[model samples]
Target: MMIPRMLRCSVLLFLILAVTSCVHTPPLYVNLSQHNPIIDDYKALTNAGLAQRCCPEFPLKDGWLGGDGDVSVPLDATTTLFLFSDSYVGQQNQTKRNVPGTKIIANTVAIQSCKWEDESEINYFWNRMYTSNPRPVFEPKKHGNKFWVNDAFLLEGKLYVLLEEIGEKENAAPDDVFNFTQVGYTMAKIDNPYDTPLTWNIDYLPLPGFQHPQTGISCLTRHKEYVYFFINNNDRVQQLVRKAVTDFEDMDHGFEYFARDRSWQSGIETADMDTLFTGFRCTTVKYHSAVKKWVMIKDIQFKTNEIKMRCSPELTGPWSEERVVYTIPETTPGNEHYHENNFCYLPRECTQNYNSKSCEMVMTYDVNNFDLSYVINHELIYTPRVITIYLPVEESGGPEE
Candidate 1:
């Protein structure tokens, strides 16, 4: 959906003013460690050409294979699986358009395998098992319309996915076809997701006490015996809620939300949910062992180009102020190609060097402007951009040389 120009401009101006006025002060976590955080530049995943065999049109003319919903699952020390949400096959123009007669090939969920050759290089390969008509795995139909996977992860050897049900309303405008409703989560038992031509035994589960008109889990993570889910309410604010690990299969009565006082309360409505972060849509949270902290990466709600990072000593705790780790120059709100949107998100399992004193986190994100009109006239900028972030070790000495 295209953001209104007036609103976009206002946000851009506000961010610019905010950045310019900041003093040359140290990072918020400077007290935890004297060494500065090392953040690398954005690296575009170029190995997408390997996936062309499944869908020749991949990396669609101007667009890329998938949009949003990026969650990386580590298969081993060097191999990882990247799962995409609402993935599609075909030219970018045809797949993203809502006009009449446009061909839409919905892949539902797409998988890509990545192998790390070294610290700075990765090779990508497509998994054909996920590229099927209607995508045989985990397809939910509601009132004759099919739902798509929004996000997924492997927990205790089972694949858990959040599904969204969406379709064009009768006689709706061309731009309204993509409107969707959060349909909740589903679980599937799979021996190995990386294996080609895989089979899945899927089960749908209801999110009791948390279901509402425009609310759904944006991202999830497990700490100790609890699974934390970041709930998004369509509005900018995100709430943190958790459920007992033992009751994961018993969805009906396991959820408890974190309240303003930092205490867990039973029932969603009874809990005074605290806002985790503002101006965030797609989000991810992971626990880092090296620093004994929880790290989060998410795109600023309206300002997609800016990816913010935050850290906390505990899962449900006093988080540090957000720091703008990376900004996509191409999507700068007032730039030539200002309409483009970008996001940087990481899965809970993708960190390879957690034991190292310096934490190195690897993740992928999408970069593309969703405006249909912009794509037709200009080349599409839709693709997943990979990046690595290094968090300095917590040492008593001054900044690491």
Candidate 2:
């Protein structure tokens, strides 16, 4: 067999290469569970008194009051951040927005002391260098005050926020409701989200083609080794895109969409991606370990006057239809609380207020009015409607063996 040393070396090299090719790293499996979120059994979280921290009820400092777009994110165990859009901060004593003075800023932020015992403990912040003229915390680097900031999530202790860039129509008036176009999206990175928003440093990263007029960025949730982003794909459908935990700085690539084949694939082609939910909103979609279901709370505007809950076994498959968790009393025409112009949207999940053992969780919806003045005069129209959701022991569906 040792006919020639050179020939023997060549034979050994071939065998080693064959063995190496056969041995490869196994694919990663992100462990998750799923169950039905029973909406039939639920009620308002009246005890939490989350309402105490809302609107004119909370004392105003520097004319800083409350606003809509209640995009709440739990930074850590005990604190939560509220990112708002089209907020009112003007004359605290003036009941009417047109009177003493009222300025509707593009955005503002607040820090909540999530202690249900004292739900009133929350402080709002924005740049007030000119006390009478406050600027948004992350003011647009451009001229327009149309940065409708949405969906924020934390990964590796850093916060990432999605700011929608809106552009006005060439000949349209300033106050026209439908005169704006979604120009683009920018993701802001905050290395110190724990500190006051004013003290934190932000790096704005521009993202193109992510702005589809019909579908827009809404929810940003992290599950296992990946952070998943869901968009209200044309109001009635929801689409998803995700990146690895190690891929934050370069969001330009490494995106995986929930494909039509029910498999995760690279790219953003709508034909390639699958719609998971029948309806969507700019809300949180997360895994509740206690209930073992990936749950999302949302309300499709103009569809119905109810905030609903939907769930799925996996983050990207066979999602259950929504069950009405709370019928929005403020939007119901005949209800005493209802105003002719009153409406509600954007049902958000408050993770910090979640109670694990009993499968109890808190959700909030942004109340608004078609007539802008109604929000200012009514006081409660532009605030949040907080409710409590309690799930059953084991409704049905999957355990994902």
Candidate 3:
């Protein structure tokens, strides 16, 4: 009898565990506050000392700004920055967070938007898309539950936004509650996303078949004919790829199930971004320069658990080990401001290339407190930060598998 694939994965995991349960690395406790002073000299030349603790100031007084995720796209003669955020009333009804506006200065574009989409708004938008009597392919649950629709990208002069729906039954049982997380994509035609409301030119398709894929979506650059997306399945943070199916029919709406055998070679620890202290929110992006290369950055939970960077040339098998890029010092509440979800680096044309050896990167991350018991309270307070990381190309070119 043929062994089932799922069981085979279990057996393989057992064997790998049975053989090498002994090897281990010394635990390193990373404190963001008492960091080494000399590391300051190691700052990248382009955005020197720019990676400081920052809290995005919400533009409106009534608005409480949090859950900030962003995508930067180049269209026409300029680059437009679209920042999608969770705008709502804070605890105690002290303030409100509304979607702000986009700011363009010279060649740099920055969007200070706090409002993106709420549960009702998305449901209304999705409902109107189908215009059918039968229920549509996607719909948001009517509870006060929330879903993320923030991952947006630019392809072929159109803006593609990945909408994530996480649902819960209106009156779910204490144990039998339902949480559905799937990725659906939509596109807009405006040269800049902030130029118009996201709902104006949006049309969507639901992505299917991946085990409990988290609401977070990663767009790992397009290579020739393939566009890779890294999604966290069942919070295990599995990596999967899909070729660009631009044809309306072929690309309409379908996804293949990625078995364990086809998993990304790396993983974040099972703990939250704070406890497991290794891998929690896993996301990736490819840096194509003189030679093609891919880099993966994950939240490495340590004392405060820092977000670390690792690089690999090829997606399948053989990945360069993990390395620490920037550890948020304890004095600075880096983790307090940056959470998981997604991150994108500022491209070459936008910054100083005086030195061919290095380039500055501005990273966007989901920010909030770690404890789940504090879910509702923490959600509103979560603030996103854009930090700069200097990528040293020469040192990172250490062979490829």
Q: Clash number for every model?
A: 1, 0, 20
Supply candidate 1's per-residue lDDT for 217.
Answer: 66
Give me candidate 1's TM-score against the actual structure: 0.66
The superposed Cα distance between candidate 2 and the true structure at residue 363, in angstroms, equals: 1.5
Clashing pairs in 1: 279-301
C-alpha TM-score for every candidate: 0.66, 0.78, 0.51
**lDDT (C-alpha) at residue 69 in model 3:** 41
Tens-digit lDDT string for candidate 3 (1-401): 11222211110111110000111222232221232122111122322221121112222222222334433332221112333433232222233333122111101113321122210011011112212221222233444334454344455444555545544445555654133333343322333333323233444444443224442344444445445555554444444544453642244343332334553232232222121112344443545342245556664443343556555666542455556555443214453434442222211111111112323344544444434334344433344343445454554352121
Give the Å error, residue 294, model 3.
1.5
Q: Give the number of colliding residue pairs in candidate 2.
A: 0
* Model 3 alpha-carbon drift over 4 Å, by segment: 1-64, 74-78, 89-146, 169-195, 211-220, 248-281, 299-304, 329-358, 370-381, 395-401
Best-fitting candidate, measured by TM-score? 2
Query: Evaluated with lDDT, which candidate comes out highest?
Result: 2
